[model samples]
Every structure is written in C-alpha cells, then in structure tokens.
Target: MSIPSKEFTGRHMLMTTVAFFTVVIGVNVTMALYASSSWSGLVVENTYVASQEFNRKAAEAKTMAASGVVGKLSFLHGAIHYDIRNRDGSPAAVDEVAANFKRPVGDHEDFHVAFAKVSEGRFEATHRLTSGDWIVEIVSRRDGKVVMHEADRIDTGGSGQ
Candidate 1:
C-alpha cells in the first residue's frame, strides 16, 4: 500500500494570503461606500460665509448675555414650551419665537416651527416630534433681530413628559 504525501508549496501560501487580503479589502471598500452615501458632509453651503455668520452670531449672543436676557426651553406633550426672562427673573417679551428641530445624524428630518406666546414671555408651539435624539434651537426675535438664542439636545425615551 503506497501512502500519498500532501506537500505544502509556495503556490498554496500565495493563494491563502490572497484570499485573506481579498476579504479585508472587500470589507474596507464596503464600509467606505456606506459612509460616503450616508451623509453629504456639508453642514453649510459656504464655509467662509458660515464662519463669518457664526462670529456675528457669537457676538450677538454675547451682547444678549451681557444685557441679562436669557431663556429656558422644555418639550412635552407634543409641544415646545419656552420661558424668556431677564437676570432678575422678570419675563422678557419678544416679537416672535422660532424653533428648529434637527436630528443629530441627518438633515432629512429638520423642520422649523414658530412658537406663539401663551402668556407673558412664555411661548408654546404644538409641533409633534418623533421619539429620537433631537437638537433643539430656539431663537427669540425682536424687531427682526435675534434677542435670545438657545440650543440643547434632548432624548425622549422614558420620561414621557
């Protein structure tokens, strides 16, 4: 009875290396494609203009803070409630209040809703939002100028409030 010997060759090593690298390269390509297709990576249309605008907004926010104008915001029962007040806790009145809701991951679900003053310095809007992580931006405008601005992140998971 003759026993056949299985020999290890350079060809066999080369094939094994190629197979391993092929899978690694394939996975990397797949991940790259998915990341590129997920988002545009452009938060603003123009970077220079956005930077200038951001600086201006920062100045405005600083001026507002110095003037003792501030605000508090909350979300509940399919409504956005906000209270604008001064450093002394006196209610501050504004011409109009605008709220912008944006999902953290994508801009597809971004929406703007205007809040009406329910009471003195207290604004509320009935805009129903889905359960997820949301970036809430509230701006109180007076005479076509931003008087008070605030931004926050909220996760509606358990409180149900």
Candidate 2:
C-alpha cells in the first residue's frame, strides 16, 4: 500500500480551511441581509387626526364614525363617527353588522365588518369605516376581550372632522 505525501496532506488541510471560512462568510452576509429587511417592532404610528398632515385621512374617520362602525381602516387624524343602520333603515343588533365596501376605490373588494352593542338607544359596531360604501354585518363577541378584538378602524381617505 502506498501512503500519501505530506504535501498532499497539507494541501487538503488548506482547502478544508478555505471551505470553512467561505461558509462562515456566506452565513454572516445572509444574516445581515435578513436583519436589515425584517423589523421587529411596530411598523406604523397610530395618531389621532389632530396631528395628521393628510387632510384626506382625517375626513374618512368621521364618515365611518357616523355609522357606529369599528375596525382598523386607515386612521388619519382621529375624528371617528358611526352611522350604522338596518336594511329598513332601522337599528340592528350587536351581532349583525358586516360592512362590505365596494365603491370607486381599491382594485380589490375591501370590506368593513361591524358588530354593534347598545349604549343607551344607539348602536356601535366593531368596524372603523372609511369614506366609502360599506355593507356592515354584525357579529357576536366570543370568550375574548374586546380589546383583543377590533378596537377601531382608521379612515385613510379624507378628513371630515
């Protein structure tokens, strides 16, 4: 049997070291790219319209608030209202407000889902509406906190308040 030369053994060791360094450098670069692309905290700020620069977003909050809608729409300045009603233009229950918005707006059919609750003689839903046409449907609250549910929706269109 023939034995390999010391030179051959030394060259193999050198190649192995190079391969290890290459892999380590590749992994470090990949990690840096991933870290830069992905953020770990809140991506947007939720401010009331009083501090907004865009007039459109502030207006949308008022329109939805008139209907007693709730959900995250597009918050502009913070003047929200709700004007929810029934098919016969009457009041609905807390579990029947499903607002389907299909207007001259986005390319896709974006909707606003609402669930009303009685506060005095008025009704309030769980969908914050924008300044558009929405067919709100009411839903019931389960064994979860309302805060865990839809707290509010923002109006990303115009400022009405």
Per TM-score, the best of the predicted structures is 1
- Local error of candidate 1 at residue 98 (angstroms): 0.9
**TM-score (all chains, Cα) for each model:** 0.68, 0.27
lDDT (10s digit) by residue, model 2, range 1-161: 99966665888989999999999999999999997677432222455543565576456545545645333323224322333343455543343323444433333655554535444214343444445433322233323311112222233446332
Per-candidate alpha-carbon RMSD to the true structure: 6.1, 14.8
Runs of candidate 1 exceeding 4 Å displacement: 1-42, 158-161
TM-score of 2: 0.27
CA lDDT of each candidate? Answer: 0.83, 0.43
Best model number under lDDT: 1
